[model samples]
Target chain A: MLRKLTVLAAAVGLAFVATSALAASTKEEPVAPSAPWSFDGPFGTYDQAQLQRGYKVYREVCSSCHSMNLLAFRNLGDKGGPFWDPKYKSSVENGYVKAIAKDYQIADIDRDTGDAIKRPGTPADHFVAPFANEAAARASNGGALPPDMSLLARAREGGPDYIYSIVTGYHPAPAGLTVPAGKFYNPYMQGDLSSFWKGDPNKVPVGGFIAMPPPLADGKVSFDDKSPSDLKAEARDVSAFLMWAADPKMEERKQTGLAVMIFLLVFSGILYASYRTLWRNIDHH
Target chain B: MTAHTTYEPKTAIERWLDTRLPIVRLGAEVLEFPTPKNLNYWWTFGGILSFCLATQIVTGIVLAMHYQAGGASAFLSVEQGIMRDVNYGWLIRGIHANGASMFFIAVYIHMFRGMYYGSYKAPRELLWLLGCVIYLLMMATAFMGYVLPWGQMSFWGAKVITNLLGAFPIIGKPITTLLWGGFAVDDPTLNRFFSLHYLLPFLIAAVVALHIWALHVPGNNNPTGVEVKSKADTVPFHPYYTVKDGFAIGVFLILFAVFIFYEPDALGHADNFIAANPLVTPAHIVPEWYFLPFYAILRAIPDKLSGVIAMFGAIAMLFALPWLNTSKVKSMRYRPTSKVYFLVFVVVCLILGWCGAQLPDDAVIPALGKTGINLIDSDLNSYVWLSRIATAYYFAYFLLITPILGLRETPLPVPDSISKPVLAGEAAKKD
Candidate 1:
């Protein structure tokens, strides 16, 4: 009798849960269309060429607004990265990453004066910020702060998909909508509360108006390795690059994970055998 | 020195050590302690939880070696320094992060098993109470650890939870300020949370030791809810339970590894990846998944003070469970009605978790085919009403239904001896 009552009560509770879930699902937000990623599934590894192209796209366009502060110049030449080469070192004498690092000027402290100074970047130096400070960044971009790109791929909801959509999703304002002077309409940018002027619904983008003017265009960036320079290709490349930036050790991690799994499988099998042997003579209730 | 059967030293050196400390004898006795022969797979959770704690502590200590506790550097230290710079840092951090969820998973199963078997009944009441203490400590430790990442959700979650102290009438504001270490959650707050997060786990370890000691005093409770009457009804803890627990641990570790390796962030909110900014708050500020049921209870009430009280009450009610349950019967399996009520309560808890995930006051009924109806404004979108109902039932299940059912319900006939089932099973095996 109690079992029946419990089942009935459970059924009622489950009904409410289902109902609430259904209601919540009705308030739909646009989701990024899935794109094929090289580093998606269990056996997936990063595409060396794709990562290289993505880095190129990031260097030419995205670097102007974004700061990859957490990424060191040495990481670019590390294993699993697009530019990774076992023989390559970030020394000025060595290879391309070293050359790339030297191209930027990083801020350093003056040893004698104990004051900030700028010098050519080194292998250990993090990517230099385009702006001196947040104030400078906002001043240059009409008060909109471009977030650091180091972990951007992991930070957002849809991640690489979201980044790809926003880069290519920019379009003219809708027929009835009037975009404000500083803002540009992008269907993919999910605006925070301050994204638009307060109480001005017409000025708000369908999703959220972003301050960034469309940053990508066909053939805007020239790739030396001869990958496609179309807007979509460029977008894909940059998104892939950001994903690598977010999780550079993914390839190594997955490989180690496989080994761990195999060890656990064999170890557990042995343990189970031992357990059965121990229990063979004893009858459990 | 102990009641349980123990090893006798056969050599002069062994006898010398045994007389001095007797630690080896203590280990032998514990391993040989008689356990109920009727224990099922549910009994394996205790071993799994212990393994989880050890895993967390090991990985956590290594991660802390690279972790920076200050607000400014904490986020970057985790995402960049530990994950990127350290050798196999990602693996260590992933294991630690996912290990927390796994720990909760094992502990929840252990708790539910205890509940189902009426493990809290007298003589074992102190054991159950000690388990509760460990549980509360786990919650506090997990909460502080979550804040250590200093991500968007971490910052806001800390802010929201600490601010709840202000709901107290006279001492609330002062307590909140002291907890925050200033006007709001800042550097000092982060520093203290890290210090306390590090300290509480050791405290939990101590309490866990007591919990085990308390359990040994009375021995483990079994599914039959009957006391061991004869030697035939019990088996040595070693060889029987130790081997079984080892196999279970291996299986549990595989499951834990899947999360660590494959879906490391599947259990976490994405917003947590973003560094915390005082100026910006995420659209929704939610706690870790384990806290959702209590979080739901907190939000169920409209008033701040009442909501806080209700959430604490939910946990406090668990401590009162042993005394509140007046039934002569211990196991719900014997009392069919009690079993039904238990199932309902589990479902109710799950619903509360679901409610916690949703925006409060959101409509439960979908607005499909409704023309020009203002549903968000109406009570439809809100789960406020439903949550209140569920919360009321939660209290009623323990306070009213448990006592009433204990007095009125008749239980199924229990076996007189554990050996009967074993003997019957052996006879069947011959066929």
Candidate 2:
């Protein structure tokens, strides 16, 4: 069996080398290394404090342009989420979700008057869009549409790492390279043709350019608990928060995984015992 | 089938039922069927596969309850409604998505076990063929399921694969059009895919019944590749194999749950979270991992028509397997050279899968650095050529190696009975 495994490994290794040799010549988008995530491994859980800080970063910075349209204000109070309130049940009457919702104004029509009206947000309302419509968003952002932040972490290749890299990867174009107007050099963003800002032979990042400028800066948003207020720290926090937003059921899932695995293992042990006893004396042909 | 005590209806109700339909008798026969005592853990995969099928069906029916199949709403429905709003919807959707992968994983193990043990040979030919039919349906069901998500990969993968049918001579164009339900993959295509996806699993279930019936006709072939000659060589399926299969399923479910809960999206492509946009295509549009081996075979050939033929032919080749290998020995374990070849075949298939996942234009491995010696074009990478070689080996393993190895290589000494090794304590050594 060992010999068989060795032979199989050698065959696969040879094939991998032969094929990868060819794949080396073609230039593809560079995949950024994933930063260590709090919820990465089986036993991992989100640091609630960090998630809250990250949510702050998103609210103050990212929400200006990007929309988290799929998220309800009520989602903030769910367990495993950043703003979960233990005291709050399903109803959000006086909970933190209600408080958070009050920070933004939501647009709705007045049922009695039959006219458009602006009102304070509640837990039921989705995150308010910065712009009224797609056309307005495009007009404001130099024709590039800002993607929704709700599933941004999952939608991108490297998840949280990709978001962090893009947010912090901005650099000046190298010598002999021209910066196209309205585009900034960021190696990680998947933008249009001009976004491929590999202008500087010396400084061009793997991916070309990005339309969204550096959205994070040092000390941009002060943390209540006084975690690091640097650009990298902010990027990491927001990315983590986005990841939680993308899959809020992660904590429940990991807990369920632990219980299920333990149950199965015990069940298997019982079955094995029964198997041994059943076959103990049946040894003839 | 191995001889067993015929079912005797003890109770009045059982007797009446037995006289009317014999359903109870059939159930009793299945439960008490004589299975070879020497059958190993590999045999447990059939039960595991059945559990996966039932899981997929149950979870799929629930997912469909909330799943919106229309083009405009399908993507949002999955990402928002199914994943977010519905109670425990995330868990159900996660299980369904990952369950497809689990199902394929079990099926592959089952098929390979059959191959290694020569379970496809002789009287089990129809059984093996029925398995192939089930596999074909599974691929179709999985493909259609992937498309219903309406993501970038979903749209592009559906388009790329559906267009492959156009490579056919005269009937290809119409078939492709009919499949799409229009000039392009639109709302109509999504609806039809949803309908067929719901329908094919039941067909697979029906065929699985036939597969089992065929297996019962000849009973099971033991790992020793020898037929059972007496009652001592066999055991009742109820208490022994049942407990064993149940334990194996527990193990399988544990692994499945790890993926379902901890890393549900790990097996999935991240790009799938993005809604389907016909205007934008991903840099590399690849099928799900299970389809990669066949996908590699498809791309191994450059011509569209030939690639299409080769892809389908790869699956069709399995149906001819019982006749292709002329070996009299039933198990690869007894055929030393054939065992080595079998290992090589498994490796080649894995490499083919890895190749399929890679971008065709990218280099798989870098050219030997600064050798100043170039084999072909300095610009051309080795990935395509390696894929071709692996693809050739995949076919040759079935077409040439099996028959030739049977005639050429000497096999190990054969045990006359399944109980011989166990009685002599050699079975423990094998384990």
Candidate 3:
């Protein structure tokens, strides 16, 4: 009888343990992580000239389908400008302008017709999406909405490196590699046949393989009195411009961080000296 | 230093591990003996819960390495991780994704153990309250984390939850805008949520430390519903409880590993696979399964504002449980009548969870006409009446039965000794 009771007690104890264990299992689901790419250290900072060229690439080609609606026209004239030089602010203002009506409605109009109503071209304007509606947009672009490019440089898995790689890394299809209809493949994407020919498979560019067709062509847009630049350089420059657009304050943030650190160090030294004097008499007591 | 000439380890690796993980031997020391004489297995949950938390933190850090914060790329970044990049990025992502479900699973068990053992009674009330705060923070963190993916479910879930704020009085619209960071849930909202979601877990860890600290002060309540009276009744936590907790944690990990490796997406919504769209809404909107009971409470009310308030109120009411249940008795083992009611309460909660998952039309009508509760104007009358009945029963279990049972019900005569109870019943019959 004693043995039976002991067995029963043990069984009940095991059951409770099992139930509790099962309950703990419920809490084990993993949360997805945010922002995998490292923006710090050695690989940081894009070249300024590359950014200037990338801006031109954007203006000439990618801007047709994508919108930088979050950016102000005047912002292009700031020091280390993402789009244009400081002297060209007036020209940029004259080139594209937004007019607000009496009732706070913003209208973009033709420069020729002073009274003509127009869509907004200001930083505050909602982006003019590529498609009119979901159905129409999908129908036009093989079911993929050409996403807004305003934050694309910062938003993808690889940050700026991904954008740079995708733009400059496109190549002609290798022998025996079949391209899917309406889908343009980038050779630098991992797992693609051209990925092997591009060099070591281990070093494919960031943001993984892309399906967007190549946007730049040799001498597609040219600047007069140019001091030797290739289409690849132009592509790299445009990507840098997009990166600045995505995070205009990044450089300023780094500078501010350094200033704060210096101030903290100086303040700590003063405080430490004050503490030493204040505690000096206490030790003798 | 003068008396003892100790030889230092020459290797850098030895020095590092020795300093950082000095408790390795201590961990083994704790895992070697018998637990307190009266300690039932309910004590095992706290250790298991800690194990799950560690898993989440580790996996969360790895996932953060690849995640993108912006609206445009957040969804696609996850897809890239699954399709390319990093050797076992997919496995890591899957484990982290499923680890959330496992974390909640452990907490619920930890919570229910507290409830069943009356761990929340008397001195432990503050501990339970801290636990409730932890639960609330965890829910917020999970909800915000889900939005980072920017999938169909993420978009709609944000919309639905944010819109709930609009049900408030005059200031509702402004509050909703403030919460969304704009006219609608957009880039600003995503950025801010990412920042907060990243921050809240650290806060949760801090609160959990307090929760455990509170538990230690009163020590642990046991199954006998009696306080420790002597040295014979109690045991030191190490050696005895450590081994028991270790064994329980091992079993828990096996189940967690199964979900991580085999059926990673089993608990997730399929709609989340699609990228977010503002214009389109999915056919159904359901919250994570762990939230189903409260979700049911929300839908149970016919009015939008009332429904919102009622759902929140259900959770808030748990705070008053210690004062409301004037039960002298701690465990259900002693209270015969209350035991049956507690079982029924569990069943009701399960039913509510099931109903929460189904379409509103499929909610059980409770045989309304036969019950003679007249439905004069609307079909909603039936639902309202049924919900009121269920809600009444739920409250009554706490307020009336608990206090009444404590005052009036005849409790089973408790054994004087823990071992005696086990030996008394069966041993006599065998003789």
Candidate 4:
């Protein structure tokens, strides 16, 4: 029975690995090259200082074109967030988050007059979009609508890794490859570019034309913590921030999982004991 | 023969209730039911499936409280209102989402176990049919539930699956329009799907009642496929199975919790995180993993109508299984030749599922590309061809092998009773 149980456990582990391999299979080239993600494993936790820097990049650069509609201002100071502090019992009361919210004007209706007006953003308010709707967003950015960044990390194949790859994958198009106007070539973007290549059809370039130009440059945004402001650092930082935005409760989830796992293990062990004991007297075959 | 009741009135209120309703007696009779003594770990799936259904229902109800059925608000309600604002809504939604997968896993195992042991044979045909109905309902529920999130996959999956009806002649267009509540998949489709998604589980629960009732009559089919000859061949459901099933459930929950907490998105598609936009279609559209085998079947043929019929026929095989089988041998353990074919059938299903996930035009073996004559619609060396081959075997296993093999094959000697093998010092653990 124990041998069978061990075999079952191994089969389960193998199956999990196999399914993950199947899911991770993508035609995209340069394959979101693996990076050292702080939150890669079950026990992994987000680096708070890195998240804060990531938030800085997002606010200074990404915020202009992209929306974080799912995120509230107070989320920045919530547990596991960029501006989180132990001293703040609630994120709404966090002075740093409050100050940041105050910098934006939020759309509202005046109670007395019932008229639309812009008001100072509150901690409870969702992030303000750069445009009113998808049409306006597309109109502003050539024809490509900059996707909302709230769930950007999760919405891509490799999560933070994919984000980091796309942000930093911009390069000079190989000779014989037609680079269209207002479109930048990115080696990490998933698409077929065979038709756009004048080179050998079989040996066509491994990337696609992206609408957004290279948004990051070396020393674009100076870090408050004096971290390097190279294009790579900025990309990595923002990628991590987007991941946090996508899964803000990861820390709590992992913690709860650990406890639940331990409890179920113990409970199963007890049940096994009782099962063996109760069935002890019965067995002829 | 009716199962004997063990209930005795303890108090005056119990006496009154026993005579008026007998609900207590019914409950006691179930607990005191004589299950076969030699039933193995494979039998534990019944309990695990019940747990899966209850988990889905409880978590689903919680999710509905926070969910909006409107097309516009549906994505927002799921991504923001539930996942963000509501307390532990992430956990609840994760359980509900992942629970569907878990339910299918348990059910597939249960069904296969029945097939392997021939629990679906003879008097248990109605029981198997009832289980089949439950499975059909489950597929419908899971499909509609996926659409409730209103993600890219949700909208597109609904559009693709519902459009299969449009492949039928004449009435197809009208049925699809009626189903969608409009000409296209939109807000009304989401609303009705929500209503149906909420409605189907209780219907499943009602059928489950009949399934259990049907099972209690025939009792359990043991691993040896031997009927009980005496009291020694059976055991009460209490304590022995209760503890055993409890242990299995606890282990199953550990697996469930691992997905809910550590890797909730592992079983889900990344595109689902993006809100559904009818204006833009995604690069790849795939249904949940459980539906992949059927999806492959649907895509096996080039013609849309034929493909749709083939897909539904795959499910219809299960319903017609008992009648198709001609074998008197109840267990594969006694029918060695038949067992080999059954294993191959399982492998074929897995292959079909893998093919379904790949692009139909993609080569199964890249280096061996273009092994046969190229078709106008699909290459012969591609996943489409692979699926066609597997689908052929899938239908053949039911329509040809089961009946013919049952007639020709020589089975090993069978035990006279459930306890006979043990008395003969044979463990009866070959399965």
After superposition, candidate 4 runs with Cα above 4 Å error = A6-28, A32-34, B422-431
Residue B247, candidate 2: alpha-carbon lDDT: 76
How high is the lDDT of residue B260 in model 2?
81
Candidate 2 residue lDDT tens string, A26-51:
24455555567888788889989989
Candidate 4 docks with a DockQ of 0.58
The candidate with the higher TM-score, 2 or 4, is 4
- Across A6-99, the per-residue lDDT of candidate 4 in tens digits comes to 6358436534743653483345457556578898898899999889999999999999999999999999999999999999899999999999
As for candidate 1, its clashing pairs are: A2-B336, A2-B337, B361-B381, B361-B382, B362-B381, B362-B382, B363-B380, B363-B381, B363-B382
Q: In candidate 3, residue A146 scores what lDDT? A: 60
Report the error of model 3 at residue B284, Å: 0.3
**CAPRI grade of model 1:** acceptable
Candidate 1 segments exceeding 4 Å error = A1-28, A89-94, A110-116, A192-206, B367-381, B421-431
Q: Model 1, B1-431: lDDT tens per residue? A: 24778588888988999889877788888899999987877788898888888888888899889999998899989998899989999999999988887788778778877888899998799999999999999999999999999999899999999999899899999998888889999999999998898889899989988998898888888987877788887899998898888877877787777767876766777788889999998888878777878888998887899999999999998899999888887888678999999889887887777777777756666563223444433363456656777898899998999889989999887656666643445447532
Model 2, position A272, has a per-residue lDDT of 74
Per-candidate clashes come to 9, 18, 37, 1
* Every candidate's lDDT: 0.82, 0.82, 0.62, 0.88
lDDT of 3 by residue, A170-275 (tens): 6665444456676655644544244424555544333223446677777876744373456665655666677677655445434544554455455545544554
Compared with the true structure, what per-residue lDDT tens digits does model 3 show for residues B1-431? 01111335457775676588744433333332222355544566688777767777787787788888788888767754432334566666766777777777777767766777687898889998998998899898888888888888888888888899899999889988987899999988888888888888889999988986676566667876666555556545554455545555655554565455433445666567657888878767777667766777787777899988987887886777777667777877777787887778766665555556655543255454334444542354344444555666666776687667667878676656444453466336433
Q: What clash pairs does model 4 have?
A: A285-B422
Worst 10 residues of 4 chain A by lDDT: A17-26
- For TM-score, candidate 1 versus 3, the one ahead is 1
Runs of candidate 2 exceeding 4 Å displacement:
A1-35, A190-205, B1-3, B367-381, B421-431
Name the best candidate (by TM-score): 4
Candidate 2 DockQ vs. native: 0.40
